[model samples]
Target: MIRSGVLQITLREESATTRIPARPDCLLGAGRQSNAIDRGDVDRTLRRWGASFRTSLVFAARRSLGHIGSQHIGYDDTERSLGMSRTYRVELGDVARARDALSAVRDLAAVAQARIESLATTHDPARSHPSTDTRVDAAMNAHDLIRATPALAREQGDERIVVAVVDTGVALGHPELRRKLLAGYDTVDLGLGKVGGMELVGDSRGADFTPRDDVGHGSHVAGVVAAQGFRLSPGMAGRSLCLPVRVLAAARPSGSRRTIGVGALSDIDCGIKVACDLGAKVINMSFGTSEAHIDAGAPPPHREVVDYAVARGVVLVAAMGNSGQAEKLFPAAIDPVIAVAAVDERFEVSSFSTRGKHVTLAAPGERILSLDRHGYRLSTGTSHAAPFVAGVAALLCARARRRGVELGTREVRDILVRSAQARPADGHRDDIGHGVLDADAALRTLDADLSASPHGRTHTHG
Candidate 1:
């Protein structure tokens, strides 16, 4: 778990002034020589910037250092893939101190960039509608609206494809999800204390192996993507494996008994990277932050890692946000990552679904029935809708693999947009990029394109 109230500093490429001696205590190993900056240099520099006694810094990927190249169950290749050695997380006592630290690091010759880490909550603002009905018929509306049944009938998805659900941890013991889940990781670092308005529900220590969902958001999202479809309705990619990366944790705000899901941007970034390293073909992000919440022109949160995952050939999908305004929300707004808006059974955009030029497509999301920590539950917002797209992406990947055809992120996205059903008469609209998702259409289109090419060329539309 990456701690909150910290500033992440990425050092510049190796230079005379930037290359300080590394300490034994520092986690800079053979491959991490690029991060060999002296701890004393950082401490002295911070003191010069008026950093309080409470300010401290540590390697951003300290927990992952020992796992490098290990055969262990929780091995993470983030440090190996993302040049993580050049990055460090500076912990601060307060927001004012964090501000000072971020400013001070810029003056350090070794520091190339620095920003205070922030948190993003789950996109689903509506309360969960818990129900006793676990019958398969109860959860058919959303899937039926998306034509998931017929799509699955054509391709039930391949077990080789893994969809990483980066959200509040999943319910490990849920009957619908247990067997379908691969071992997961928890990234919520409690650190010395909590920073945001919320508090961790159970464990007080930093993140560990277990990713049990105290808040049920991740479970619901996972169910939408790959639930076993035994007692509840089948998921979009029922046969695909689900890898839960617990970035968001259960949070209870002051004077509120109700719990919500919240996670720091750093943790989310690590979770995404780890998921990619662990062989996830598709990553589902059911949360986001608005442009107004971030600096006027600062890069979107998780931009670096998002690019890393895309480069690794992983397809990224995110919610269009529940604001229902035309403003942009990050990650989803970021290019190449599929942005999904919520549509009702009538195939019309939901009032709460955010609209923006970045929106890539729409799917059934209103009162969508999915899994909960306990049993079946109904939830709304783009959070649920994004998984529908993610699941479809998995289907496309699995189908491509079965046909011995390679599908990159761009190809998958292109297939989705071209095969989307019911485009607005005028053309691409902000509410729905092309139109509502048609999973079966996407697979059929992919097959037609593969068959037409002598060398199995992937289809693309400019």
Candidate 2:
């Protein structure tokens, strides 16, 4: 018989003792009764009694605390900011007992709340990255193909590579995405939950490392890196792996340019740290400020951070900027990065893509189809060109890893430039870079190392 306001408890006679699941609602709280037992509480109780039940209760405290949709709790331990607190992991016996334990510690706030979500196996280091063959096509422009995949899988696109795109942010729900995605961070100066400024004061409670795209720029750049490569052309089917890292934000809803410049350096630094920590082999930076020496004749602090990441085996690919002048952009102008210029479908230099000595290569940037807010749209700028090289670098890393040869940023840079199919330019125009990206030719050179083996094939180009 079921009692009113109480849950229906059905007992199943099994081979062993009759163990009951925990029911937090069965216990009274604030001199009142809960409508039903909390499933998480019951699961926790059963597990305490050594029941063989598998479930996930791991959600970062900061992400779950303020959200009422989930039954989450937070723990307090002033001793460490990030490590787990023992006070939250005590045994509560049966379902009834678990409720009692929770009620007792609920007042403590931190003891019975949520936990941080762990990174998944797909994103873990041991887990191999996805395939890239589905991204490349034979008809891809020679330059587009070179910078569009990693050197490792230049021939077939089966290699695992990681390409980081630093921009406004991405729409995680994009159709062409979801699978190849690793979590990203928000560096937009949207102060705490306020309208503008950085979130200087971070989450007060637990660790929530979920990445979100504050603006659409990162998503767009990511699309260029790993969007369904089939979108590029028939020949460029599958060959790119995109990693989204947010380093900028839309200052206003209008999308018109506004200066929220103070945190740019900090945002970029944080992004570089996260990308490196996540083991991204290649980073695509598509944003920059033209005024190199912003004030007091000093360069931004992120310059050093970029150098550090590059020194640590990170290949930095950046946009030469769209200022349409010989003026150089920091980070991009840094020697460690492969600076890119933009080209159109007809292979002409974009009027806006920045040029100068820093330019390393160019790729199709004008009218490039990439992911955006609503869905996919055509965007123009040198920003789109950088990822082509970033993807190509990923292929190179894969090839190098297979050969048991580790590559530093400098070596990677040299290989890319040497492999490039130089565009017919009137010498390096401050805007067009060394030339447009040549994926087919670049792949051929990287594959030259493994020509003796059966893994890579030999092919000559025009």
Candidate 3:
């Protein structure tokens, strides 16, 4: 029987002779053929290798894909044409056994790929603490730098425009964020029993509807996007709604005072797909893994779901990482996603912000004021910088909808890049991409485009 560790396996499409059974216990029962293995063979193989069937990784998506068209902010013909592949999860006793099983699974003709689920963490730097001074003026100055005030004056954003914060999870009861958050999902699945030496999930056991934040990173990121300005602190998109999808959980390593946000790639992929299916117009991913951490020749993680989200007309924003190096990071480095780097109040790129060709824009991420579980606090990282762009993307989508136009992922990215204000001395550099994010300029460009286009026609950039 399956005991501890988890591994994800993707089966070949052509080998399938039967559909994946609805029962969670059923393991790779895709059918029997000259080349393909049946359910009995799958069970015997796993049992022989000291592993067992856990669950289907793409089962939820398969069930929900057909129903996504009925959701609010429905997809167009392009989105409906995309298809999902069959992937499954299995449990093993130890890391060595898990690795062996992965190798064995790869030999099977039906298996396309197999991997030990990798973990991703939030972009917050080590030992980063929140500033005690939580004043409104400091937050407003950062917002003003990006001309968010003027952009909000033009369009305060729409409740219909949802920006999914796919991070740890948000504080559901935070006064500043309660009204702005929509129902979210949690995809953290740490098998039936904990894997030895990899107890990353602090309190989270498995998937659930309640996405409460045990760690504060997700709450802070969510606040940047849609926190309601209380007494002094102002939210970037006050009218926009934040959908909190919990993929990362709190994990405090040995001798560390702070809990780092950690999550498996399987959960993250599921979270992204869920957010897209749930009608999120924009998704802010504030976590990443540096290129150094990835093994050579490994497939880029989250490629499928990122493509799925983009095809469905959802604008994606991701942190450029805080490694202080010119390294590539997944999801962010992947094309179609708008990668954002950290900039300080002076519009200088943060020392910690990773520089790469994929970076699309810069946002205030140094000592920036945002929300925490306890109350408002100031933190710094590309994690916070990403949400600022996400908040702005939500506003752009709202403005487009108000003008009776639909903005796709490419259109939104084009507007953000075109209207970005270049730094005077540095010009467009690798660290900051086009330049610092200018909310007012982007909205104004969108307005001009809609004005130039015929009424009721969708305007897209070449």
Candidate 4:
């Protein structure tokens, strides 16, 4: 449930008793996500006990949740970021009952920050950052941004580096993404089954059973990361084995295609774990929402989600966001995840790219053309920018693995930031981080690092 939100209280324990170990103290909310409560058990144990407290309200709440299809809760055994706790979602009629339940739930500890009302709005740490005009685009062009010709000349592709795109599901038929796919999962089915309270419209093939991309966003982003680019920039194509982990639902109807929809935190958490388990060396996150900075002391919702991926040696990359404002958003604002901002053809920071110190690098994002369902099409937003960086990271990872050089997140991020062509603006660096993304330049940096290290491999860090 949104109320007790800290990466879902996942407790790992198998007790002999029929009762579960970790559970919420109260039940006054609409949804809860826990691995511990199965539908059969919840209907038998929780609903039965809940009815006794407030027969009418409990019955009504269950019925309402059922109508919205909340019964299709999600489960992921691979996610261990928060304490191992089974996910559960249920509605409770009374706060008093919540208190009483908390008192008796000896195995679980309730934290004040988990309340839903208190966490409704979120904040971006760098939104208020003062604007600064800069010449970073020139810096990237001087170093060859997006032109992967040189990198490919050295090595055709890195089969070992798995790059995962955890966004809306991807359209596998897109010619640009044919070889880029590894089997992916659909997390939208794990959600409340509604977008902004409206019943979902896309997924005619039933994405719940097989992941499919009704929205083209995921496929477009995947193009930037690893599209063969047969019809687009073929020489600049990325060849990392792409993993599409669909988290958002395809809700908006746009003729033959559906548009991206809002995603719940549970979907993202599940996607991150699946990506890591599937051997994703690089993961791209292209979605985010603004949060109120007033709650600075409160932990942001997705902090632990980002941390979990980083802890597992996954090189996480996130979009700086398309808000066109300075304040930074989640995942991108998180320290370990490399935040990428967008730049245009002229190498100027995109007007829509989010600006902030948290951004690690800049990439071509303004109306840049990439793969689409029918052919190549023009698209914009930090969504495209982040994948460019992800593609470069995967390319470098591929080359490193071939040379017997194992690299970690810190080593890869350092290479991109340090090798970037400096974009000095008015005597200081602007919000676009170090500069524009240069695929060839980053690979050269990786090669140099390997040569300098012992036995032709970069130093590893846990």
Candidate 5:
């Protein structure tokens, strides 16, 4: 079985920096695209490297969260192809440990852009894997966001919309989430036996894999997004279909004593594409890579995928990191996607919630209750905060469908922003964008848009 610890290389036709014929990897970086930035020779070169690294999912972000977009939300991209002489695992169980290769391939256009394909863990220890004791329901009832809108209070059904939980994995047996989950793909096992996006943007698209959640983070995040209200009891949200895509894999090499949860931005990119292809209207990302950590101008692995989703009419929402500092996070920091921060019942931003221009708005990330394997429980983090926005976005989609009007990502984002209860702060209200997410306000905004139409087309509910 081809495994991890592989060295991925990239070369260019004309580079003043490199010496040709580096390591004798056959024909590497033979030609360049007309754009020059996008190379075709490298695409073929990657295919020859080995089954495309599964390119599916390498696992990195989140202590449990996913990037580091279910990026276990912070998949660390860049530096994946920096060093060339590393080991290259071939598909037929062949290993090519190339060394002393700098002189073999002179056409190395750019060497700095390439690095190891393996994802390095990027979890913030100060605020990851938050688990609070069984909190009282009264704690939830006091949340102003609970009363801020009709998220839970809205008596209705909007099960047609699909929300992809691009996180670790989701509990399939959970009573509340079991029925709502759509068939999701796991990038860990997905393969690129055939050529796909990997040739273009270096993404692994075609493959077969299973979506399974080992850590409870992805499941909890799903619950907040759309955990289906149960008959025996009720829960926070679940008005949309929950599509679970497992992108995070074990920390150790495959077939070892699996111990850690890892995620890759590439995996997140693949998951986002899978969700989009499967028709997910809203992609909920509960993990992120802090901008404070990455080098300037470094390409964000999930940025293209996130933008693609939005262009396809998918609303992307991600947790601003838990650093409580002004910085950018993957998917969330991408601008088009909604960046959610955390706030408490008093509407006070959580101490650990990230604050900066990237934040779209605040949600109840502190000790919020949602579905788990054992029933409802409380969990904290911006990881928990993002799904709430996703759920409300789903609600708006459902409402749009009823009104016979279509809602795009921007429309959804604008509705949320305009309907939000504004607060006072420095520079556009500091971290919390607009204000706390109010489900009812969003609903009202949707209705207002529908009513103001020139045609004044009207529709009704069941």
Candidate 6:
């Protein structure tokens, strides 16, 4: 993950530094680009601009090249790489020089960013193949566990659970999520742009960005977690509130032809931080880098950040990924994260959902109902399966809070796993994790906890 907080590049120091005063534009759009950042290209970029000119903004300098384009430069973020990176609009003694520097900085920075992004995708396996099949909604195990319709409706549906969808931006005005959105943040934009600007920046298509569902991925996942009004059948009708965080904007059409991979590690890390910072108890992550083999030591870089979030008492759920093999996806693959694998209506694992030792839970990923700008659509993917767990996690959180229990990630996991209906393949299979999540079973577990407590005081665990 990119870590939390903003990385501001200032042109001037406090006292003697000349301020170029310009808004920093995200060349890659509103979120992290899933593509790889080419190391060879970055090397070539630095070499092309040989001879160290006045790079420090704390001191005065002149604009060397006014081709008026920006360059994307990556520093080691270490002692050696510090203060060497050049940015746009330093106090080149005047505005023209500042403008030229700013332009140059933007241009070159774009090039460098492209290179770095290429490297970013190299480590992941999810982006290896391109697909045109839209996401489908899978059935929930609620039917088998609930038994009765009215009771299920009364006990399960009305419980308002807040799920934070940390991915590309959500369509805030979408009828399903608009009502339930308790709070939201752009994280990448710092909430600076106007309502329309939000979409424009998030779409990553320049000034003409629209918040509509360009790619149905985020909306599909969000709808599963907390769509406002839904009807799976006769008695299945309910909705949950969704908090949309636009981490990945639209990709540049020419740059990425197939999929738009914007949500970067930094964007994801920042999104999680924002969700935690906003007091969101449940976080849903449908996207991941690559899948690792089982028995691997610790998790990758992105997984570590997720662990930190889980430590803070937030329930994090992620997609097992769509590789159709026994591999572990980051964030989902992490021990703390509830990795969700997708199963179809037949109760068979989806061909796209990855399987491995880290698979902790399973959900219906085929023909699942969700909302999009076009209307309700049947979607499929482990991505959709994750939000189902997130919704269940929120319900659990609500029950815990109602009973006055200070729950952490571990305690939450314990309750959920214990409540689940043990399956035949749970103990050893690399496919389904435990089994498909049972909402009614989870609720019953909370009921048991509340009954055991003294005067409604729940227990705590680390």
- Each prediction's TM-score versus the true structure: 0.86, 0.59, 0.86, 0.72, 0.69, 0.63
Q: Per-residue CA lDDT of candidate 4, range 1-462, in tens?
A: 132211222223342112332111112233332333433332333334333221110011111222333322222333322432333223344433543333333233332222121111111122211122223331223114555677677656666778888887677787777766888766554223443333455652223534566656777777777776565554233556888887666554234232454455545555566677667888988887555421343366566556656666788888887767878577678887889887766778877787887888888775555655455555667887888788777777778778776666777788888777645553224467887777878888887887787463365632
TM-score of decoy 6: 0.63
lDDT, candidate 3, equals 0.72
Encode model 2's per-residue lDDT on 1-462: one tens digit a residue: 000111111111121111121111111111122222234444444454423222211111232232333312342232112221111112222434433433332333222232111100000011111122333332224333444444333454422557767665567887767566776654332223322222222321112333455445566667766666445421122343556666554443134232221223434554565576466777877776555433222333345456556555777888787767788676678876788887766667777777787788788765555665546555556666777677666666666566665555666666566665655556455566556677656666666655654343211110
Angstrom error at residue 1, model 4? 15
Off by over 4 Å in 1: 1-4, 15-42, 50-83, 93-95, 127-140, 192-194, 454-462
Report every candidate's CA lDDT: 0.72, 0.48, 0.72, 0.57, 0.55, 0.50
Preferred candidate (TM-score higher): 1 or 5: 1
Which parts of model 5 have CA positions greater than 4 angstroms off?
1-132, 142-144, 148-157, 189-208, 230-238, 250-261, 295-297, 425-427, 454-462
Off by over 4 Å in 3: 1-4, 17-53, 62-85, 137-140, 191-202, 295-298, 423-428, 454-462
Total clashes in model 1, counting residue pairs 3 or more apart in sequence or in different chains = 1
What value does the lDDT take at residue 162 in candidate 1? 94
Each prediction's total of clashing residue pairs, residues at least 3 apart in sequence or on different chains, is 1, 48, 0, 29, 44, 48
lDDT of 3 by residue, 1-462 (tens): 112356666667665323343211121133211112346455456656744444453434434343422121233443333324355555554445765666676677776766666668774775257667887665536787899888888888889998899998988999988678898877765443333233454555654557788788998898888877774345676587889998887776655567767777767887888898788989999888666655343367787777788767788999999989999887799888999998888788999999988888899887677788888777888998998899888888888888677777778888888899865355467898889899999988888878887452345421
Q: How close is candidate 1 to the true structure, as a TM-score?
A: 0.86
Candidate 3, residue 116: Cα displacement in angstroms equals 2.2
Clashes of 3: 0
Superior by TM-score: candidate 1 or candidate 6: 1
lDDT-based ranking, best first?
Answer: 1, 3, 4, 5, 6, 2
* lDDT, residue 168, candidate 2: 56
